[model samples]
Target: MKKSSMKNRLRPLLLTAVSLTVAVAVSACGPADEGAVSAKPTAAGVEPSTGRPTTPQTSPSSSASSRTTASRSPTSARTTSTSTPTPKQAIVKNTAAPRTRAAWPRVTFARLTFEIPPGWTLTTYGSDACVQPVHRAGLPTMFDCAGIAIKSGSIAGNELRSYEARQPGGWYAATDVQPCPVRPTLADGSFNGITSGTSSPPVESGLRPVGSRKAAYDRWTAACTSGYRFSPQAWHLPVSRVLFLDYTGHAETARVLESVRFPG
Candidate 1:
């Protein structure tokens, strides 16, 4: 009986030991450790439970910020440009006005005309054989039956006389035309009337006679008295239809003779 009582005491001790082992296992496997802290939920692109960071979420503001930074980069900076130039021109100037001259007077007679200095008289007479009056120094106030006159003018204080006459068969009438105290005639019977055999004294060279006529210079002497005498120089030009004659005491006579012309 003592042995049976000892056995019951040992069995109660074994049950107590088994119950303490089960409690220890339950405590170890059921819940986490009390010293460790649990993580909270996080944003997108992050470990939610662990609360560790990942790639950040792309927001509208951040995208705009990136574009702004790209625009301000060194390769995209602003710069300046160049331009072109212009040209020049030339300049001119004008200084003074032009000069003019007065018109010379025209003297016309006997189907002919010529130019003379201004304010000169030209008197025509058809009364006696178509006489044209002229005046010269140391000579009579003469008459040209078939001629014209360029009277005294202020240019030289002188007068120049010219004649043009129509004759039969190209004959020259010295008395009716420009009379000389000593007259001359050609041997060719072209001029039948005159005082003596003709002498062909040459006129100044290059003095073309009026029209197609040839030039002749006739020098003559008149004996009015010892106190009054005159030597005259006459230039004659005989053409097909008319004979031209001139008398002038001035050196400008050739210039005056060259100005003669026939009327149409």
Candidate 2:
């Protein structure tokens, strides 16, 4: 009976040892199984235990895209800076003094001499004469060209013409009344029947000094159908038949008239 009891106690010890062995085996396998689970692939971006999104692994294309974005940042900044506009500068006006008399140049035409502003030129077409800026084109070579006696019709200058049969009446005598001399049509250079109508009465008429001699001064306005209304001024010396005509509204006209000189 004692032997049977001792066998029962040893049986209990063996059972306990078996239980410990099984527990040891299970503990060792637990770590290996957990490591296997960790090594295995999970669905795309999600974690196995948390079921939450995990950090994405970088790929070649994604790294290239990041590099591309970084490269374009400087270009975008440069474009934005260049698009801004700059302010405009202010304009300046010209304000200077007039030129003096000694600075003027002398010009001789026909038998009379006159002083013109520097850089002025005198051109003669037969008995007719024109005084204008040096840059102006030469006058037409004809006895009576169009706009020859009107300020608006010609360039800003002076015109001098000798007495002729076809010439307008106001050329020699201030009392001689005439029609507007500017022809109606520019296509034909010849004079047409007084299409521009009669001239307005003399605005001013009297004797004016011209160098050593006195001249008959007359100023009148004339109009033409070609949309030109011009003033015709004349200084006529009856003895010399020297007619000085100024058609332009030039500021130098008064100075030019005052500078006219005649020989005794």
Candidate 3:
């Protein structure tokens, strides 16, 4: 019975050795890139892992793997981003217009509009009410000025026009625009008689035109301490003549004149 028992133990060990040898041999013949066979340890030239070769998903363009093993079909994780919205702005429409105003005394002298000094009177140099515009002799040619008719009361432009038409060009010596100095301020620092004082009324502004500007530009200065240099566009009408009244004078008066605007 002891001898039979020894035989039995030896037979079991032999059977175990045979089984392990066959399993290893079968695994060596299978696809190496598939499954975990590549991880099985071996001695010498034993077959590598059966898992398919795996590739690093470094970039979409890369197709090669680091080693032969089971391959993992690349799982692409693609994500997209959205944009943000912007705010709206409010707009205002400009529908209002600027207003133009007319100042008083829109008075006429030598067929020009000008500011008259308060408490002052004007008189004509000639006996005929319809004589030509003449000025005091010995004054600068560019400083042309006429003694306007302001007897008893200021003459209405309409009333004067009617009376003037009795003669040619509305006056015995009908005159066109004269080259008056811009302001009464003289270059030689002389005012003949021009002087200034406070408590005197503020200067009223005037506007005039300079035409197409082909005429000679004779710029000169004289004494009109209270007056200013002025210019304007001239438009002659059948019954009315257009003359721009521009002049430069004292500092304060010049400031007011700058506000006058020209039309297109």
Candidate 4:
């Protein structure tokens, strides 16, 4: 009887201990099962519950913020830029008015045209043309005419008859046959009928434009007796068979030359 009672009491204590162990095991496994169910594999191959790769799940607002940052990245911003580049401008030529005196009269020689001061006379002797100030006497003979003259066509009996003639030939070429002053001395346009023993070298010698054509230009100074002086400027266009001369040595000479042009 004593042995039976001892066995029965030990059995109850053992059963109670086993029941506690089973309950503790069930509690521990309960959490694991819940976690496994919640961490089911997602379409992106990431565990949503535990986040095994540690990639934080982005909320709606956070996802939008990320997208906005990507749009403003340097590469993306450059591609989306709408600013336009300025175009280069073209070079333009100067179109200012011609340098000339106002209210001056216009004169035409062959195709060449230019301006002259008022009261200047224009006369033609055969094929030669002459221009002189109104203060001068009657027009001089073809050979003796003072002031500006243009010799063209057959210059009768002069070595300058040949339009193609070059220097040293009297009345026949682009250069002066005699050196003269660049300005005149006599108010009446008269000089002592004698030339001084000295003549100056050409003051300017080159190709100059007259109207639309280029002419050989020559200017020189000539000294006459009684302290008188005369400057002779010449413009010869061989192609047009025209020769222009200025002997007045007046200040308007340069202005007149500058005013030269061609009529269409």
CA-lDDT, candidates in order? 0.41, 0.58, 0.32, 0.61
Superposed by TM-score, candidate 1 places the C-alpha of residue 161 at a distance from the truth, in angstroms, of 21
- Can you write out model 1's per-residue Cα lDDT over 1-264, one digit (the tens) per residue? 999999998999999999999999998889776555334323455554345554455577887898788877644444222222344565666655666655656665545565555434455333112212243233333234213223211111111223322111112223343333222233453432323212222223233465334554444433321223333344444442333333224443454466667555
Residue 49 miss distance in model 1 (angstroms): 99
What tens-digit string does per-residue lDDT give for candidate 2 at 1-264?
999999998998999999999999989887557778668675467666567665555677887898899999999999999888766797776667767647578877667778877777676765567676666444321124322221111112212333432234343232323333444335565433333313334667888887766877877665545456666567766666666676535677777778877766
Worst lDDT window (10 residues) for model 2? 150-159
**Candidate 2: stretches off by over 4 Å:** 1-102, 137-201
Candidate 3 residue 153 Cα shift, in angstroms, is 24
Query: Model 2 compared with the native: what TM-score?
Result: 0.42
| All candidates: TM-score | 0.31, 0.42, 0.24, 0.45
On the 0 to 100 scale, the lDDT of residue 69 in model 3 is 22
Ranking by TM-score: 4, 2, 1, 3
Clashing pairs in 1: none
lDDT of 3 by residue, 10-90 (tens): 998999999999988988985666456645445334444467544423432342452222243222111122233345586
True-structure RMSD, every candidate: 23.2, 13.3, 15.9, 10.3
| Candidate with the greatest TM-score versus the true structure | 4
Q: Against the hidden true structure, what lDDT does model 3 obtain? A: 0.32
Relative to the true structure, candidate 3 reaches a TM of: 0.24
Backbone clashes per model, in order? 0, 1, 40, 9
- Residue 219 of model 3, lDDT score: 20
Cα miss at 218, model 1 (Å)?
2.2
Q: Rank the candidates by lDDT, best first.
A: 4, 2, 1, 3
